[model samples]
Target chain A: MRYIKNPMEIEKTSFEIIGREMGEHNFTEAQLQIVKRVIHTTADFQYKDLLEISEGAIEAGKEALRNSPLIYTDTNMILSGINKRALGTLKGNAICYVNLEEVHKEAKEKSITRSMAAVEKACDENVDIFVFGNAPTALFKLRELIKEGKAKPKLIIAVPVGFVGASESKEGLEELNIPYITVRGRKGGSTVAASIVNALMYMIVER
Target chain B: MRYIKNPMEIEKTSFEIIGREMGEHNFTEAQLQIVKRVIHTTADFQYKDLLEISEGAIEAGKEALRNSPLIYTDTNMILSGINKRALGTLKGNAICYVNLEEVHKEAKEKSITRSMAAVEKACDENVDIFVFGNAPTALFKLRELIKEGKAKPKLIIAVPVGFVGASESKEGLEELNIPYITVRGRKGGSTVAASIVNALMYMIVER
Candidate 1:
């Protein structure tokens, strides 16, 4: 095992290696940052083929992010991983209502998952970004709300990882004709989702 | 998109599907629970191959859990995802030092990552379980401390996801000759680590 001189150095070297591994991409600079961060997190190169980025989605996401949009995630993991400083600079907030008492009660009453209930709650609010990285049901519920004209987001990041409804939910997302950055199959989680958001935030600051 | 009737039902169905996908294992009931939870989180059956559980590691982990062993994690995400009720019932506490003021200061002073500094801080505490799901540097630091006989954990869950030093750190852990549950490659994260711990806690309650 090689000795790690320092964390930053290791991270920088890793990013360099990832760029070499995933060379010759057609993605924009903004989108490339998000892709590299995802690849950096998972070390899975197959993401090149699985990831589907809608046309002009990165620019749209960057614009929404510059507005300090209120971000919502299906899981607390994604909420906590978000760069608070970046969000704070833009006066934006990241909220995860999965464990809220009201959400729990509503889910129980409605016979739905807490994640889906959380999305339903977001639907009523002025949410700018929707990120689902754990619960596919949440993405499915979000799709329904968008269809009914109850919710509209600048960009939807639907990358829930699991066997049950993961692939199916992303497939549903593909038919929405709305803007999204999603993995085509059952391979994603809060880490990847948060990385995507962080990449966008970093791009905003750097620009 | 399909509607989720309830969280419990969806989780039950997912577990059943996982069982069928990973048929006929020699794992004990507790081990099987951990395996199923990991598969359920990642939807990657290959985890069945990547995850390495040392002999009697589950029993050791169970003993620590029953004793309310102090839990330490590399990320806030893992800390937030743990079964707090189970830990509370056992009079245990989950601690994440990465965000601590002292950790940040010390890491800067020592020119290391906050995660590695957190491991140094944890090495001084009365910790029983070391869960590293995000930072391989933390895992490597822990391995160093253990080699110097400064720290001893009842069980180490060393599954950090990344390209940098991730696999090498787990490989470093294998030579420690300590009881551990680790994934051999770069296919793990805070979610998977937290799921493994939750599976252990649930098995404890179920039994």
Candidate 2:
């Protein structure tokens, strides 16, 4: 707020404000951290109610981070916003394959969204965490792959915001029996997804 | 497709793909450029029909870019994604005041979104182009300020994507006489907003 040039300080100040605004809201520390990051990104407090954090998603995320699992994101902004230094310490890599030729070719061949193709490609990469911030189709594809036993990620961050397939994709996540952190309706993006990843990074390494 | 590392080359390749996909569609050259960038970012060809580019918006944007006018954005990602090197060559700056302390304080006092407060702050900065990617509230507030004769921007890029006020906000943009590039429904974000800016940059300087 005070012309904060240091990214870490800016992030911390945002969390403090979020903490103050969330007074009396009941949530676990890890869930609260994710909520704070989401609020920090959108400045929308309704996320306090809309955000659905699974009982052990944060724990799963932390364990995945500790094991240096690859983080596959649906958008480059999510990849760019992650705490790279902290993740680097854990040997984790934040990867996004949205614009690759293979993805485009597969999407065309399979009659699917490029986001879906990207998720399919990510399945071959040993993904530990799947972060779908901008693409509901990607989240849907991930859910399908997980249910079919073709992919097994420790955690899923599904927060694709849009009128089309956003709510339904998150609903699909709920039925997967897999650990996930998601919002119920259409209210998320790369920024929110990246913030969740940062929260996980902080809990696993910074905290 | 070929693991293109050069940003310009990557952009050009995207344009090529967009050109192939848009074989029979009739659009002005400027409109095609904007559409290409939007598709490049989202990988969604449906944008061909969803996006609406005003006849004068690109011309207005190119003029503003050439004049080194101040650029206002709704999110940090939009600010960061802009080609700063080209902008610096033209002596312009991409500004996002949403996270500033002043915006947070004013938003609290006014019971408005920080994005709205940030737009109010930009009123004093002589903003030439207003790019709203993530905040419908910000776009709504800007419209209010413009109607009240409190602020005047040469061009507006209204593409806020979400379920809430996204469509209604873009509808508000249409009522204004100033030129704008907007989507009809709920589909947009910082990535699309940044792509529009990048397209304008390429048209003005990169080419």
**DockQ, all models:** 0.69, 0.06
- What is candidate 1's lDDT per residue for A1-207, written digit by digit as tens? 356757667778988988888868787776777888888876777777778889877888888988869899998889988878888887788999999999999988888898989999998887999999989888888989888888889899989997778888888565666789999888888878998888888887742
In terms of lDDT, model 1 sits at 0.85
Candidate lDDT values, in order: 0.85, 0.78
List the candidate 2 regions with Cα displacement exceeding 4 Å: A1-60, A64-76, A79-207, B1-8
Top-lDDT candidate index? 1
The sequence of per-residue lDDT tens digits that candidate 2 reaches over residues B1-207 is 112223345456546756886668888878888887777665556678888988788888999988977999988778866777788988998889977888889988877788888999999888999999877778888888889888889999998865456667888566778899997776677778888988888887854
Off by over 4 Å in 1: A23-25, B23-26, B172-174
- Per-residue lDDT tens digits of candidate 2, residues A1-207? 112323345456556766776678888777887887677655557789989988788888888889867999987778766767788889988888877888878877876677788898889887999998877667767777888899988889988865455667788565777789998876677777888888888876854
- Positional deviation of B99 in candidate 2, in angstroms? 0.9
- Residue pair clashes in candidate 1: none
